[model samples]
Target: MHEFQLPDMTCGHCAGVVGQTLHLADPACKFQVDLPARKVTVQSDEDRAVLAEALADAGYPPA
Candidate 1:
């Protein structure tokens, strides 16, 4: 599992977008969004930098 902070994620829609983006990047990836913590945890075999770029491209630049 990998962890990142997505400060811009504020609602279910944002969560959905983030989730979808990750899925699009790596369909087998599993994610958990902790809205209050502004954190996202992803379980994937993909590279972290690639995932980060995918998230950025999806509009939720990680912290």
Candidate 2:
């Protein structure tokens, strides 16, 4: 699992968007977004950079 800090994620809608975007990037990947903690954990074979790009494209840039 890979963990990313998404400080800008502030609501259920944002988490849903991020989760959907992540799924769109890699359909088999599993993810959990903790909006209160500003963190996301992803389980996948894809590289972190690829995931980061997907998050960025989804409007929730990862740190």
| Residue pair clashes in candidate 1 | none
Model 1, span 1-63: residue lDDT tens = 889899989888999999999999899999999988878999999999989999999888998
Tens digits of per-residue lDDT for model 2, 1-63 = 889999889999889999898898889999987788999999999988999999998888987
Off by over 4 Å in 2: none
Q: Model 1 — TM-score against the truth?
A: 0.95
Top candidate when judged by TM-score against the true structure = 1
Clashing residue pair totals per candidate (backbone < 3 A): 0, 0
Instruction: Output the TM-score of candidate 2.
Output: 0.94
TM-scores, all models, native as reference: 0.95, 0.94
- Residue pairs of candidate 2 with colliding backbone atoms: none
